[model samples]
Target: MKFLFLICAAQGRPTATPVDNGTVVGTLGPVDDDVEVWVKEYDEGSAEDSGRRLAGDRLTGHTETVRVRGGEVLVTDGPFLESKEYIAGFDLIEAPSLDVAREIASKHPMAHYTGIEIRPLPE
Candidate 1:
């Protein structure tokens, strides 16, 4: 029914920028190598291969983690977890099935360099 695509990339990677050829590069090579990466979510109402984009965008730099310990709220800079990678962006997609959702995620350029986590949402 619905899925959340967590677009992750290596820490400190640069944002997606359009090259001179007017192609968007998302943390890796050109997103328009042979098939362009669909940066947005697929349309829910249409079953067409090329559907309307629902909602998606690249996240800005910097992140914060908030936690409550000892009855006090604590806030810290950067992600809550320490690792070599971080969530670079996200795409909220509507797919007919998990298999199709995986297909959509594979099209992302970030999937080539890092990884994309697909989580299905409850109906």
Candidate 2:
């Protein structure tokens, strides 16, 4: 099974801090052979630019909302939520099961400071 982990933080880039990637890689090495992981961060750009960039890629960074109502298009910047939390990055990981995926997500270095939401992909 494959799981997508949405990494959320308080409205900033995931790599904004000087995190030691080596440490994280070492921590996850045990599961590395069993799972395939792809990590991506949101691009540093204006909301409109980010949205446009995301349209051509598999990952989305900062977001914009467009709603059509009564022939009018309403546009809004930032995430859909009213809270400060925003999705900063994501990890697409292939694991043996949901339990294993959750375990792997929990081991992510960002999990200590931010939130990781795990969702299973269709087999």
Candidate 3:
């Protein structure tokens, strides 16, 4: 099975290593180095990298909406939805089972600091 890892954080760019919150913190996972290793492991045999960062770094706190209604097109400038979190990027991987996939996701460096949502492809 193949899964998509949606990396999320409560603040800015997906690349930022989050600061420790005031709450008690536990052991931290390896950061940038592990990310480099993870990327190399996934990209070694592929034609292109298995993952890529998103453009949330350029959000500028504004968004544009597009829609077609009543046979006409409409455009608006504003946030479509309210969200305290943003998807920083995605990683696509193949695993034998959901458990294996979850394990892979948990290894992502940001998984310790942020959230990773695992989703299987329907098709």
lDDT, candidate 3, 1-123, per-residue tens: 667777665554334443533222122334546666766665553333333322112124555778999989999986554786766567777666677777767766667667788888664
Regions of candidate 2 where Cα sits further than 4 Å from its true position: 11-61
**lDDT of every predicted structure (CA atoms):** 0.65, 0.52, 0.59
* Candidate 2 overall lDDT versus native: 0.52
TM-score top scorer: 1
RMSD of each: 5.6, 12.0, 7.3
Error at 63, model 1, angstroms: 1.5
Stretches > 4 Å off in candidate 3: 12-30, 45-65, 76-79
Q: Candidate 2: give the clashing pairs.
A: none
> For candidate 1, lDDT tens digit of each residue in 12-92?
544544433544444445653532335423444335543334576778877887889999999988676677787877878
Give the alpha carbon lDDT tens digit for every residue of 7-110 in model 2: 66554433323444332222234323322221222222223212111211123665798999999999998667777766756666666667766666665555
| Model 3 pairs whose backbones collide | none
